[model samples]
Target: MRKVIVNNIVSLDGCYADATGNPLALNMDAAFDQANLDSISAADVVLLGRDSFDGFSSYWPFIADAPEPDDPDAPEARALSEVNRAISRRYNAIPKVVVSDRGGVPSDNAWAQTTTVVPRGAAASWVADAKRNGDGDIVIFGSRRMWNGLLGDGLIDELHLMVSPTVLGDGVRLFGVPADLDRIECRRYDGSPNVQLRYRVLAPRSDRAS
Candidate 1:
């Protein structure tokens, strides 16, 4: 069975995006590392809510299309940028399912061939069925509303949270008010600027005895 992994880059203060709904503070530079690369590359499908779908569809496809500006003083940075470009290519190739309650269809854009738009109420069943028969992992990125719904349905199998070192005093928060005490199954800190956390959600608060 395939697993649904909710992967997010959150700030130290627990915000997923800045006050203006930008994810600029997420220093995802280190994610080019092997461990992180493997996690992202393993996804055969990506699940996204409207916000994330719009954001990613506008951004990730052409992220590596331009030439990198030369900076002789920053050789390491230049090399890392190339690595990131390659990673972006791999990511763009994965199939994506965008949950949009509004009637939307894949566009004629180059990247749209791999995308599918599903209505909100129908997405839950599609995701659950995918888990039962899909070939690889289904990754969900930065879709809070979709996350809440899936979590409530007990459809998410793992959460790969990438916590950045910086703090955002205020912004749009991810993982809003919890309905229960979710359990952490495992935790690992890469020897880098960010920490990755993995958690397993237990049953709802009312279902658990004190």
Candidate 2:
């Protein structure tokens, strides 16, 4: 069976994206890029909402085609570029499922050859079925709404959250409901203001009380 892992990088205030709906507006550095690579490499399939689908499809392929590191940049910059390339390649290789109620995801479906689009109404059940039958990790990236629904359905297995140094006093918050989780691991990036947290979701609170 597969485990659903939700990986997100957010501001200290818990905002995944800024007011402009730009997740890149938050703090992300070399450590973050390496983490991204690691996350994608571990997952065989990715589940996304419409917003995340649009965002990833429009960008990841291009990054995959980007040039390798050159001598002109700093050592850290070159290392970051290498990591970004690896991240995009992994994203392109993995199968992805996008949950969108409406049409218009492009006939070509250019992000990856294995893109699957399902209606929003059926997302939870589909994920549950996949988890029951599939292998490896099912990863969710930048789909706050989608993951929250899965959380309500008691489908999310684990969460890998990176808290950056900056705080977005006001932005689109990631958590709309309370969740019960058991911390699995926590680590900090040396010389950087990034703290990564891993948590295993417990059974729903109501279930535990009964």
Candidate 3:
């Protein structure tokens, strides 16, 4: 069976989005490093909640064309530009399954394609079927509610969280509550701007006792 990975970037205080609901508070250079690209590229299928789907679909497609080499910011922006280009290409090419209650596929005017919509209630079944008959690992990014459901359903396999150094006093948390987990690994990249915590979700306490 394929493994389901929940990968997200959050602030040090454990907030995924800020007071204004913006999820872009982290330092870009630290957030989109080589390790981030590797994790994203490892998956063949990307899973997204409605908000995540909307956010990514609106952006990544134009990333490759952005960033002017001659611009002043270019000196400091070049490395990240290349990384975003690579990630954008991979993100745009991979098939996506969006879990949403709303209807209709968003218009495919750009690189967005091979998209499938699964209603909210059926997300677990969809994920299970995909895991049974799919290829490569399934990855979900920046989808809090979806992650909550998956966590409760015991469908998530690996959880990767990139915690930034800044602390937001108020915001939406990546995980509403602490969960019992077995640490697979913890990586702190250079500069220590962010740390990636990887954990394997263990069976529920009840299940472990049986």
- TM-score of each candidate structure, all chains considered together: 0.81, 0.88, 0.88
Model 2 ranges off by over 4 Å? 68-80, 205-210
Model 2: per-residue lDDT, tens digit, 1-210? Answer: 799999999898888888887787787877787777888898999899988888788877767676555654765454437678788788888899998887756777676467888888989889989999988999998889988878878899998998888788888888865679899999887777888999999964544321
Off by over 4 Å in 1: 32-36, 72-80, 177-191, 206-210
lDDT of each: 0.72, 0.82, 0.79
RMSD of each: 3.6, 3.2, 3.3
Candidate 1, which ten residues in sequence have the lowest lDDT sum? Answer: 201-210
lDDT of 3 by residue, 105-125 (tens): 757635345788899989999
RMSD of 1: 3.6
The C-alpha stretches of model 3 lying farther than 4 A from their native spots are 67-69, 72-80, 204-210
Error of 1 at 166 (Å): 2.6
Model 3 is weakest, by summed lDDT over 10 consecutive residues, at 201-210
TM value for model 2: 0.88
Clashing residue pairs in candidate 3 (N, C-alpha, C atoms within 3 angstroms): none
